[model samples]
Target: MYRFLITTSKGLEQLLQQEIQHLLPEIETRNRPGQVVFEAELADAYRLCLWSRLANRVLLQLRSGKGETGDELYDLANKVNWSSHFSADQSFSIDFVGTSRAINNTQFGAMKIKDAIVDHFKDLFDTRPNVEKQFPDLKFHGRLNKEGFGIYLDLSGGSLHQRRYRERAGRAPIKENLAFAVLMRSGWVDAIRNGDESSAEIPVFDPMCGSGTILIEAAQYAAKIAPGLHRHQWGFSHWKGHDIPLWFSLLDEAKVGQITPSMRFLGTDIDAHVIEIAKDNANIADVGDFIQFEVADATQQPNTFEKAGYIVSNVPYGERLGELTELLPMFKSWGGHLKQAFPEWHLSLLTSDRDMLRQLRLMAGKEYQFINGNIECQLVNFHLDEKNCHIADKEQDNHSDFANRLRKNISKLKKWLKTANTDCYRVYDADLPEYNVAIDVYGDWVVVQEYAAPKNIPKHKTISRLQDILIAIPDIMQIEPSQLVLKTRQVQKGKAQYQKLDKSSDELIVHENGAKFAVNLHDYLDTGLFLDHRDVRQKVRQMSKDKRVLNLFAYTGSVSVFAALGGAKSVTTVDMSNTYLNWAKRNLALNGIKGAYQYPLVRKDCLTWIRECEQQFDLIFVDPPSFSNSKNMQGSWDVQRDHAGFLRLVRMRLAPGGTIIFSNNLRQFKLDPDLQDSLGLRITDISAESIPFDFKRNQKIHHCWVMQDDA
Candidate 1:
């Protein structure tokens, strides 16, 4: 028996082992990280090349010994009978992997082995073989490390993943063998292998079939097609010991063993071009009749299957921030479509982003990690049924407590929400310290801000708790997973907090009291409207009648809109961000408050603008960031450090009897005790009254005060 080595991708080692054992049960096998080792006859190798769908390459070990130095590698290779493996008339190539202290470069090590073989032939036959890099008549693999070296005869010409049926490929196409691995993880292959006659008739479908890699793999398995039947050449084709007759006998067996599958497979892709390519690939693989390819959007595709089966595909998960926002709605709608169209079907999806899985609103019973090409991805499996069809409360100990707290908070607010005059409110505020996150409802959407867990907590524990909270909140809040947005809220310095989280540019309109304001929950960390300041904004509206208003650091101008609607003579909004300024404009126009004269927007650093301003207003509102080192300003501004001087400058711009409503969300914030004497103003602390009823759980959400001239 010849000792053979089989290589596969990371995370598929165990699967490959199982596949090999099933194919050659008599062979003694062992498993490694990315490869498997076994002792089998030559015919067993031939059988594996034809049948093993989860292997990358099958190699026969020719020789192995210590190769601590370059001379040792050459001596080890020369000891082998070179003519027995391949004749000097044929060309060969060496694929060297691993390196040792003496032979650090792979190319240099491969050159040493080639020289040893050539020198051997020259001494015996007075001639040598030529080295061919590509399309070699014979290929050999040499690996060298501190432990030693092993020379292998590469039976498969290149990686077995190149099924040769793919003449063209789409973007980021998965390898054929990797696709088979995914099928194994999804349990599609096992169901067929160990199923009854009726159980084997379950159909397979791929909704996002890019170039048909997944569907073609499923079809080949179902139709009993050999994975390597389409390849024209192999490393053993020109080997001296290769028995062409034996290879042909195995090939004939594979050809005659194929049978028509009982069930048909379906593949759909939104791109028409990709669908045509998939059709061509399917035809080349000889499974065209088994699979039906169509050009249709995955989100809107209607299920035409007579019975529930399996839906397995590689769902598109955006790698960039902007692409994620665009894909959110598609995943949500597609998830809804699956719930409505295919109720009892099993769904297995592969994605690089875990967030998209949450968007599906389906509870994954199992998840497996694998490397696709270079990307580390997750294969999440879900069984669709009426009970768990939609997002529901999870009963795990980690999840129940958080969900129970959210349910209790929502129960308390149910009556108050109906009469709160605004649909936006806070539902949960870290009620359970172990689950440290704040939840706010903006009409139909829920924004969850996860505060950084304490350093003493384990990272994995924090992650587990956060995931449990995400799974639980949707059900308690009575919203779809699409309406849930999660963000990490840590102490941000300078202008980092204001930087855009995503370029979704998506805006939603929600009402407060009688005024309408636009808020974007996805683009930035803080949605334009701060729900905790509901009471403060109303106070501003009630006090702004017939007065001129100036809103400093007016983020999206929520307060300015309320002031304009309160019949202010004129409103001025100042902020350094042109993005927020434009957003403020949209908010004003959204509420029918327009015209530059009535509401002027100035894009200047509030600190710099307040110093150069010549106009005075009857009312001024200052809610600057806790700390800002924005590039637009000459220097940074800290609420606690600069509030005294900052308000003194504002006092110069204040009309007599005018009021300045100043606020900040800094939890440890303290009003400058000497500001009353320093700015010559009477500062009344209204922080207690500023927090809305829903935010009572977190009294430090924000601090508010009404400052006026001490006349």
Candidate 2:
């Protein structure tokens, strides 16, 4: 019997050993972290090269001896009769692993091994073998440890994991061998390949199938197809001792051994481009007929399967803080969707972040540790039974807590809501630390804004709490899910505040203080109406009577609508986005104030417009975004840095004794002292008076100021 060493990933050694033991029960085996050693004949070696899915390389141990120095190692290699393994005209390459005191540099150690092989060949024949690093005819592998060194022929050549089927790969695609390990650990291999008739027919699916690696691996295993059947080259093909006739016979046997089982394998990805690539890869593997690939979102996966099966996926594990925040609720929703749709299906999820897996809320039955590249990841397996399908008891407690807080806040705000005669108000503003979300009511609709959780907070905990909030809001408020809009609030940079979050151009008319304004909850990051500014809009209306009003940097012209409704002589609304300008006109029309002469909307750079305008206004409202760098703007704008210049321009167009109202959502804003002194302007901090009762908890939501020239 010949000795063979099969190398796999570090954590997959035990599974590899078990696989080999099953394939050749009588073979003696030893397992290590990344390697499995066994004794078998040439036929077994050929079989392993053709069939073993977890092995990266199948090597034949040519010789082993002890050596301390590079020269000694070269001598050990020289005694192996290099010319017998490959001809002088054949090209070869050497791969050295591990390190010794004398072989500190792997490249130098490889040179020493190559020197021995070349000298041996040169001594036998006048010429030596050529070195071919890329596609070598014969490949040699050497391992140098503290004890000595072992050299072997890399029988499988360029890693067996490079299954010839994948013509393309998606970002961070799991290696085919690792995908095999995932399938094996999930018990899918046994269920699809060797299980009883009923188990063999169970369907397999991957919802987040990137380039369809898992699906392809599953299809091949289910079909009893050899992993290496389609390979064009192998190290044994050119080896001097290779049994050509025996190898061809084994290949023919593998071809005939493929089982056409009646099994279904499906793969879906939200990215259509990646789905096309997956199709190409499946076609290349000759298993396209066994697997179906489609562009589908995991959140919308249908429960059309008539029978229970396995759902395996490598869901996205965000590597950065921002990505983690975005992925939290997505994982939570995906978990809920899976529970509601596939209560009987089993799940195997591979992720680097265990917290993300916990967001699924399903208790995993088994977890296997594996190294995906350098990241330590876990393949968590779960059997979704009735007991574990619902939200845990602790999660229910969180939901109750959120509900109680919402009720308390609403009760406290009832008096203010009645006095203001407004149906829309802030019901909850992060009342509890765990459930950090702002709940606003616009008539029957509720908008839930989730503040970005601290980086130290576990993503699963945040997601669990968010799920609790979502469940609590509808139950507490007695509204449908369609009326609740969820949004994530993060520190936006540049023009991110103005950027559209979705493509739906849906607009709804909502009442605020007996006035009608158009609001869009689905199209943009911020709904059209700012509920916190309800009192501020009323203040603008009270002060705008018989005055010519200028609403600078006006977004949707809600302020202008209030000014016009309060009987302003004329109102001019200035903004950069034509979309918002059109929205401003629509808001004016909604409020029964029409005609361009009544409320004129100007779409232009507010800064440039202010510079060129000569008209004087009795009241001017400037509420520039905290920061903006829109392509239409002249240059980037920062409220803190450019407030002086922007205000100076606003002052130049203001009539004597006229008031300039400035407001911004930058919580940390500080007015420049020099501007106050230089412009001789009397400024009052009206932030406290501008805040409505519903926003008492977070008074710093915005800062407002009224500036007047001390003429």
Candidate 3:
């Protein structure tokens, strides 16, 4: 009998052993951590390789002995007859695992074993096999621990999880073997086994099937298809002792083992592109006809199966804070959809984050832990029955005060919003200091900017409060969690404010008083468009008609777009960032405003450009940042300290009868009180008028003033 060791994921050793025993009942099997050991014939090893869906690799053990040092390891490996394994002309490779006292590095240990094997072959035939790393003729696995070292011939070639069917995959695709194990844990395999193929009672469905890994696995398993039937090559293919006829016999049996079982499987994804990838993968697996791939939103898609069976999916667990915030409501909504549409059906969801499971609100009947790659995950099962389905809104749980306050604020803003003709506005701005977050709406999306909690508040308490806030917002705002973007608002210095927090570039076009601007909620700390400055942008439009308009620090060109639409003869926009400048251009294009001659985009530090400018404008808007120390600028600038000198330059650029609208968000800003007399200018503080109704609660969101040259 040949000694063999089978490797699998850490938590799946027992399941893998059970699968192996069922496939080869005569073998003496023993389970270990991430591995299973058994004694079987060479043909039995091949059979297990062909049938064991949960095993990663089927290794044929050749030798095991004590090897405390590199020399000892070399001596032990050299004791084996190298010629008996393969001819010296065949290429070979070693995958060494673990460490020893003298051979702490895997490469060093592999080198020692490699030297021993080469010397053994050289002594016999005066030649040795060439080392081929990628596709070797014979692959060897070396492992060492405190007990001893063992060498193995890798008979499965590569990891069995790579079924070669999924040429394309979506984000965080589950491995094939793990998906199978999930099916087994869900009792899906047993259901299929008992049900008649002619009238299949069980229907498998995945609402969020990215590349369709799980659904494809289920379809293949239900159809009695061998997991390794399509694999053309094996680790034993080129081995000297490999019994070709026996391997062929096993391969033929696997081909014959596949039964044309009727399957009721369907997979769907919200993304149409990924659905095409899923269809391609299913076709490659030869199960395209047995399954249907469709693009449908999980939150809205209802159960289509005539009879309830199983709803299995690897629900997306957002990795980033913004993604997590967006997915929370999605989980809640999907949970509600399942409760309403697929009641009495079984639901199994795999996710990496345990906290996300709570968003479902459905009581998980059974939860099993599994490992996908290096990440530990949980497979939560739910029996969607009346008893377990807690579909009531959980927003009022422990945060009813915040929820009521939010509802009150939204109610108060409803009339004002209709009169203001703005769809994007602030729904809540730290109404209860305990919440400490500003929630803004941009069309259908919501952005939650959390101010850093006080240092005295415990971290866990802050996290709990934040979670409560996230849970309440979606239900109250009547939006999905996927439409919410979360960001931490903190004091920024230097160029830190301008640096990208993410690269999603998920920009959305939002309208304010019929003017459209592109806003990206996911990429930066601040969205491209500022809602607090909405009234100021409108004022710029009213003041710029039939005049030359200049917008300094033109962030995203919102003011410039408004000015252009307001019939400005010409508008000049200046900013140091090319990204914002391009965004400004897009905003203009969105409103059918274009032409460099009519509206010029200048890329220059606003502070330096103000000193060098010779052109005069009838209307000028200079809204500088509170603090800027961009590398592109010459020196550091603080609005509180530098306002006096900066306004002097701005005043110089104002033409006869020109009006300068100056603004800044520095809360403690005291605009040089004496600058009016010193620079011969009349400064009118419009901070109150510029403060829109939505921002009346936080009156100091920004300070605005209208300045005019006094001759």
Alpha-carbon RMSD of each model: 6.9, 7.6, 5.5
lDDT of 2 by residue, 257-326 (tens): 9887577899998899999999999999989989988888898889777798999887788663334544
RMSD of 2: 7.6
TM-score, one value per model: 0.70, 0.65, 0.77
What's the CA error at residue 647 for candidate 2, in Å? 5.5
Candidate with maximal TM-score: 3
Candidate 2 overall lDDT versus native: 0.85
Report RMSD for candidate 3. Answer: 5.5
Error in Å for residue 60 of model 1 = 6.3
Q: Write the per-residue lDDT of candidate 3 for residues 562-664, one digit (tens) a residue.
A: 9998999999999999999999999999999989999999999998898999999999999999998999899988999898898889888999889999999
lDDT measured at residue 51 in model 3 versus the true structure, 0 to 100: 79
Q: lDDT scores for all predictions?
A: 0.86, 0.85, 0.87
Ranking by TM-score: 3, 1, 2
Give per-residue CA lDDT, model 1, range 278-333, as digits (tens): 99999999999899999999999998998788999988876643344347657766
